[model samples]
Target: MASVQRRLSALLFGVALAGTTLAGTASAHVRYVVDDPADVGSIVSFVASTLAVPAHAAIVGGSALATATGLLAFRRVRPFQRDRDVFADAMADYRDLLPWLLRLAIGIPLVGAGFSGYYFTPLLESDARLLFIGLGFLLLFGLATRLVAAVGLLLYLAGVAVDAVLLLQFEYVGGFLALVLVGSGRPSADDVLERVASDDDSTYARVDPVHALATRFRERVAPAEPYAPVAIRLSLAGAFVYLGLVEKLLNPGYALAVVAKYDLTAIVPVAPELWVVGAALAEIAVGVVLAVGLYTRAAAGLSLVLFTLTLFGLPDDPVLAHLSLFGLASALVITGAGPFSVDELLRTRSASPEDPDA
Candidate 1:
């Protein structure tokens, strides 16, 4: 039953991916915006003149037929349930084919549609950065599974969010989600079960903490390990602080004017200079807290609020700088410094009173 369900699920997912790709391709080509604007008379004329509808129809029809064939293949494999063992064996057989079908359905259309869209859409040329970003995301999804590439996915999604806000082009978010789903859906339940069944008993032997600690201390930390969430958070915080300072330095008069315009005195109902001082101090304090991973969540939250306000209040400038700061703020809020954090150290100490560090 599980095997049948898995096969059915694979077929459905493949069909869905194909349908989405076809729709995206059709939308890309059969639009008024694709044609030469100077020669265009009316919207309808532009669309009709540019779109190769017959070609699109032929491609989509072929894809639909292929999807139907995949479904039929799945149905043909459904009746081999002689026993539990036979069912398991049949599922194993299906798994081999199903992943390949999914790869085909998802990959071929994305590449084809991406190329068609890139060539046909004038907007993509105007905003080449976004096009490159989208292509990078698709390539990343193809190269690595989402679980192993979670950090990369997170970064890409962050970039997408910032781009969406700046350009008001929200479709990229949907594309990002689709890529994530495709990359993350690879390892099924049967794969996990097989891995567990194949585990060696000796590998589960108890560890000596003293020896473990000695080994850890003696060995140099691996470079890849620094790419973990906590390290990323600290690095991101430092970058944000540096960028913000650079912005302040470049436009010192403007920065001071912004501080004055907000009327910190009236808002705080206290000494005006003190209020300005407090805000400045708070910015520095939050950066320090984030750097040391102390009160990380609170620090990140504060930083987010500060950056959001800056994004709205600052003078209209290049979109990239604003978006980059916003992305960093969002990342800090979402990740909140992982294991290599002062907050974690405190939590560990509190949880275990017997520890020497505690």
Candidate 2:
């Protein structure tokens, strides 16, 4: 238990260090040529510059105190009193849903990237857009998924190389990378192949060794049931943290402007600037707690509330944008943080003497 705690502490320290480095970079790029909130890519830079050092210190101090208090209280209780780990129980058959979740997260974005019709222009030109859309459908329908995922991965890699904006958009990059590693989920063509192979073991045994090896290799990268929920939690955590840092903190002026436009100040009975600062602090804290997988249910539930509130203020153009994030937050609330989080570690160590493996 002590060793595990040390390892967890080390991992968390590394993540915090990385975040600090990124924040510094964000701060350096505060001023930009384009201040349009619609651009989205520059939001983090705006946040770092908007919040002064004292403001940052106050928020950090408050979050630390809260986290410490919560940890102490959590230590005193026997929360995981169930026979099994709650996360494992909730995700008993998660593998069955992994493909669908991956498809929605990765494929939907590809579709959006290529969508250029009545209301909006495509992110890519005609030929590229068509190819992108084709890849998206292939992924979504579970048709030739490996080939499509490979192509999509390469395409995103190329885009990142050419356009730095994609690097800043963690959601898209994270989704694409996850698909590349996991391939399509169950009920896809991959499953069909597996079923066919299993149906005739003798025939499969006679197949070329190289082909079998390739198949085995692909399976190695497939998403496992135990980890999918945690992966989703991490992805949402990164996206939210980035948004909180870049979108709200870095761009307080724009945030305040939007709040005023939507009469958010009137609804909350707080000054717009104070509201922006408070919201940013909450967002950042939620992101950090979620990222570390600590009190994940509470953090995600709070995030869901925040996301729901935003829906009331969002214009039509951005309303759809928040829906997926809201869904992710809601899913976390239902699923908890899974095995990859600090909550699980704490629960495991704090198990009673009678339940040695708890």
Candidate 3:
């Protein structure tokens, strides 16, 4: 079941990506001038906007399809009986899971920040963008976290200065810095490196009482192995749920206005009211899946698509608003629902001693 679901997710995502790429490429050929045709600056501006336009548009359609597909998939695999039991067991094993969970919290944002900077042009300079992506990988993998964290800190500070609304980015940088100042903690590649280093011939004297006292102090002050990642995931879930309800259900005028304002009528041929209702339902459905941690990757992947599409309609001040959700969704893509999710429940059931798959 898991394998099949994975394949389905991959197939849907691939189709969306391929379709979007083709559409973007196709649209590029239809020339439209923004200013004097002979002006180099005007030509560049027109070219950039043309290339970007299709992608921004395609993301909405792709996300809507993906979200619908995920909901259908979840209906097929959602564990009806043992979800509560699984959650209980997950909590029981929390101590063992803490390090791994912490890694998700720390690593996902780094990766999200980096990937967004790289893939989304106009966000950063080309060279800096690649560097940002590399930084995410390094941080995600727990390789040279101290150095990566330091770099991330500098980059995020610069980003905040450029666009202060991205306070979340700065917040993440601070978390990374905390890890750098103290340590990457358990299950990190840093710990493995330290372990290997410890085995080398270089010997050190035993710690004195004074040094031990300082170590204790540091431990006391060091950030409580952060759980911000968990909060981010839940917050995303809540935000989307609220948006779905308020924007589409309770007061659809606003949604309709947004759709009309963005000239998104092309994405849906049916009446705007029906499309709005469907979109709202999709958001609510996706939010429920996220909240319950069912098929989280699929849900997050679809959310990523929706968030990407939303960029086109957003005003300048809020243009980057959805970007943070993009990061969270990306992080969830990497981390899934974590230990506290229905996906884990299904996995645990499948692997149970009573099950033949075990």
TM-score of each candidate?
0.36, 0.68, 0.43
Clashes of 3: 0
What are the lDDT figures for the candidates, one per model?
Answer: 0.37, 0.55, 0.48
How many collisions per candidate?
A: 0, 8, 0
- Pairs with backbone N, CA or C atoms under 3 Å apart (clashes), candidate 3: none
Residue 45 miss distance in model 2 (angstroms): 16
lDDT of 1 by residue, 275-309 (tens): 32334334444545565676554455666676565
Q: Candidate 2 on 1-358: residue-level lDDT in tens?
A: 4554455445434533444324311111112212433333455554444354576557656766987887778656646646435554565446456556667656665666556420111222344667767776788787666667667656655765665444343344334444554566676766665556555565864663444654766765543434445555666666666656765677666666566656777786755655666776766676777777887767767776766665554533333223345545555655567666787786677635322121
In candidate 2, how many Å is residue 104 off?
1.9
All candidates in order of TM-score, best leading: 2, 3, 1
Q: Supply the global lDDT for candidate 2.
A: 0.55
Candidate 3 residue-wise lDDT, 1-358, digit = tens: 4554355345333422322221111000001111111222343343334335565446556777886786677555545337534544544454444334434555564455455553222333334556756775676666666666667657655665565333323225324434454445566676665555555453432322233443454465344333333333454565565556543455555555566655567876745555555566567676667666776766777777776666543443233323445555655555456544576676786644221110
Q: Positional deviation of 336 in candidate 3, in angstroms? A: 1.2
Question: Model 3, stretches more than 4 Å misplaced?
Answer: 1-229, 313-317, 352-358
TM-score, predicted candidate 3 vs. hidden true structure: 0.43
What stretches of model 1 exceed 4 Å from their correct place?
1-131, 136-227, 249-251, 260-278, 315-334, 352-358
Instruction: Give the range where candidate 1 is weakest over 10 consecutive residues by summed lDDT.
Output: 23-32
- What local lDDT score does residue 133 receive in model 3, on the 0 to 100 scale? 62
